[model samples]
Target: MENKVATIYKNQLQEYTQKVGKRLPIYQSFNEDSENFPKHRAKVLVDGVEYISKMTHSTKKQTEQKVAKITCESIFHEESEVESFPFLYEDPTLRKSILNEFVIKKKMKPTYNMISQEKGQSPIFIFHFAFGGKTYIGEEAGNKKLAEHLAARTAIKLLLETNADTLSPIIMSKVNSDDYFPKCSGNLQGESSSRHKRNANTNNERRNKKRRFGN
Candidate 1:
């Protein structure tokens, strides 16, 4: 139940908005308590615009983190050349899903380009994903699939970290892969969880009020 990456993004995003004179970030989730499938998608209201994560995740934290990370990317790079990356899943299939998620969220299809270099005897393949006019290049690999994943992984790493520079030095230093995934947690997560529960309850009450008025 550790959601380290999500906590980092949530805190950094809040701090970023504060620095830029924006209101506190607001979050809402869809289908977060499914009886059978614990699937959910998170949306954030920032600067009067709503940004929702394209893919549904198994947990509320994951979905919220995805949306928050993308929202951070949008606001951080709005006036600069910096870009945002996402957390790619370890499984190859899930890793590719992250790319699809990006396309859905960004409304841009990334074109991949590959080049092969001759090694001692065989050739090594290097792949690059051309996304948002930025080229994320991967290391040379023995085959095409591995090379493609490597490139995608590199893109996710760089895209997310670019905006992380705006975070505090302590938060920026915590963005390592080992800790950025689900394996790590912060002391603030407990407070965050409570705040999210309150927000969720408020959202539900508002929805009910709307229904009552409509009826």
Candidate 2:
């Protein structure tokens, strides 16, 4: 029999899927040994991936809820692992720029979830965003906004590296500009300043060489 707790978990799972903009479908099948038997098998599909329950239950609702719980856990685990890149956290400005150019401009909502919070520990947050029907998950962070930025940065970096020509002109311009590079301050200020000067001198030398060669 399907208890109230299982029902609640099932409902919560459904709500979570809807909040994340993913479709979760629960499918039920009957035992073939006896057409009139009450035993039912349940399976669920999350993001097109299917998960089946370990065994059939007495009622369809029980079977469905069991399958739903298993599927929900799997979905959450996969989404949590989506944050594969750790370097995005170093540049929040560039991250925000990526989000503004790609996600915000595309008119898709960014979803966030606080995965865990323990006493004396930073909260773990996950960010989710979709583009062209494909959802991208961001690396987990201590704060919601940071997690969102990380996610946006990951998506933008992946797109820029793999599919730059497919990006919009505005985003492409931002990616190509040195203005979007990470700014240094405090302890790193001296090093960054020296590096900038070196780059400028190199550019001037290149320009002078070009002029001399008439090319």
Candidate 3:
């Protein structure tokens, strides 16, 4: 009698599951005869903070051979905004040109005053260049934090203007040209002069090597 009652309950559950999704994240299905039985379960995939929950369920032996295709429809919140994520870093030139134009074209408001080297103050409008294999990453920085942040915003604007279809999460090289250019009121001395000389030497060597091996 107990087994018969269990069977009837199981059948009803299976029918309900088939009619409506399990509602709960997890659910089970079982096919019990006088001896052995078949059992199965299901789960739902989650993404970000988008939807609250999903429904799923199981079937009986009559339809056990049939596969139920899983499908999902996105649900949006009242105040939420959804946009497709762009494919960033797909092209290096697109990234470089976007940054370059931003720096050259726009004039950012001054964030700080030019300070003396003795005070060891950094300069406004520092250029950063990250070396990428065939391309380069470039950014601008001002002495003030606000100015630096402005540079990034300006760059992003210019990029959008040029390529309306560009993807999000912009990609570029990791070189910083700002470090190479510092703000000092007077003559180059000590490490400053040494760095200049080294840069000049490196440029000369590259030129000489290129001449030695013609394109």
Candidate 4:
């Protein structure tokens, strides 16, 4: 029937869009400097904290590898004048996928996965800071952990990289545990569920009414 075909098409479209969305951030990560993946938007992990950094994109092979090649030698080499740090690709597509997964898909609760769920693996770094006296929390993920961590080493890094600077220092600097803080509050979740159920029931009733009228 036409209704069955329309439902199949909608499902297929949703799946296809999600699949493509997931690949955008990953591809943008590799093709650093493209407008699709701006550096300022990329997340950098330092110590045990994740910070946004000033994304300086490098097109050369040396620069691409620079981010992945961080070592103790480069980080603290006796000859170093300035701190040697690696570059990160800020893939916008990946970010959009994440937003969609949390905001639109609403399948997974929006939380930064500090460890691999499948393997119980922890990320490479963990750094703590303070806003006055309270603890500030941050963390890192993925293979570029070392390089990313080094970049997130200072308050300056945080200030320069994210919109955090725009927030009141009191709230922005409240260093809390990296817990799941959904943009939508937990109390509203039940209300949202109820609304969705009501909408679904309404739609089904309408469909049934249409069928009955046609018969």
Candidate 5:
């Protein structure tokens, strides 16, 4: 059974590579122990990025096929086909849920920097988060919360694209959890308020001087 699955995965991978004009994914395997049982772990690299399988399997061939299947599905399928996956959350709440997964379960801290701001306008924010030793920057957004979500969503997409199987069990569980919701942080709120107030005051002072000078 494992051999049949491996052969199918390999054929699918070949078809995908031909259509996309990319090289076949490279697979590497190693022995590992899981719950005191001997297991084989496989990692596949597509387009120079590594994607790991979710778990070690009884056979190296099975592990390799599982990893290849995941990569092929992600690369060859349409968005609707893959939307059911936890890592491709399109909604803000889901995105925040994944972010919390990184924070609470993965023990990673997320930082939002107000990269640009103008008076009487929504500030531009940049969100920074790290995964698997790689730092990812989210697209700049008009507010800190939105930026953070974008950052988290971006990170999640990249992880899924390259190595969704590598995610920790706790993190994966959080991604699939139904109860996860966006929670506001007091510190982030305070920082935003402070910056807005400062910008407002500066703008007001400029207006006052202009009025006084009859300009």
Candidate 6:
């Protein structure tokens, strides 16, 4: 039973996804089974991030609304614009360049391919990379290039979250060259400048080390 409130939030989520160019919110009847009588607890996964409702509802559709409502609340706060998501606000194509900079700075090569998914639907693009001696799967679009960009965006988000603390040093070492980075503006540019200024001597030492070792 979808009520007016539920429908409005769901609609908002749909519009937000479209605006952000992400896949539509996918609602599941139950991500974790419930022992309650209604037995309808829902979850939604968008942009590889999952949101599960805390409470169960009477019907599957209601449960779906619960997840959708929560997802909407999380993404679309007081400000409802693409700019709200700074990291993801860039064009999908630019994200590829950023992802490349991150991976290449670590001297790791990413392997990309496609895998069979739904029988009638398009194949799923898959990206792979290795770090700390462990292989990780990382994507799909119409063609390889497009798929790579899409995959890059996904990988960047996941990796940035996964490597939040350690990744900064990996990035800081490459500050000697501007060629390795994509165009940045606003908060990214500001924070980058602050970091660069803070680590000026470190950057110089790393550059000198690279030169001496021919790395």
The numbered model that scores best in lDDT is 1
lDDT of 4 at 123: 42
lDDT of 1 by residue, 4-122 (tens): 55565677788767878989999998885665988798899998999999999987778888898788767766543322323213334334445444544566656777899999999
The 0-to-1 C-alpha lDDT of every candidate, in the order given, reads 0.65, 0.59, 0.32, 0.32, 0.64, 0.58
Tens-digit per-residue lDDT, 143-165, candidate 5: 77787777777777666655555
* lDDT by residue for model 6 (52-169), tens: 9889777888888778878866875675333233323134434544555565556665454454354356655555444445444535444555554555555555565666454444
* Each model's Cα RMSD: 20.9, 16.7, 19.6, 21.7, 18.3, 17.0
TM-score preference between candidates 5 and 6, better one = 5
lDDT comparing candidate 6 with the true structure: 0.58
Tens-digit per-residue lDDT, 65-105, candidate 3: 11111212222113111111111211222333334333333
- Model 4: C-alpha RMSD to truth? 21.7
Against the true structure, what is each candidate's TM-score?
0.38, 0.34, 0.22, 0.21, 0.38, 0.34
In candidate 5, stretches whose alpha carbon ends up further than 4 angstroms from where it belongs are: 1-88, 107-112, 118-122, 166-176, 182-215
Report the lDDT of model 4 for residue 24. Answer: 16
Task: After superposing candidate 1 on the true structure, give the runs of residues whose Cα lies further than 4 Å from its correct spot.
Answer: 79-176, 179-215
- Superpose all Cα atoms of candidate 2 onto the true structure and report the RMSD in Å to 1 decimal: 16.7
lDDT (Cα, tens digit) per residue for candidate 4, span 1-215: 22222233233323333654532111012344565654323332333333322334444332222232232223234532222111111221122222222222323322222222232564454433333223323444444443223223333234323423332232222212132232322221344556778999999999999999995
Per the 3 Å backbone cut-off, how many clashing residue pairs does candidate 3 have?
A: 9
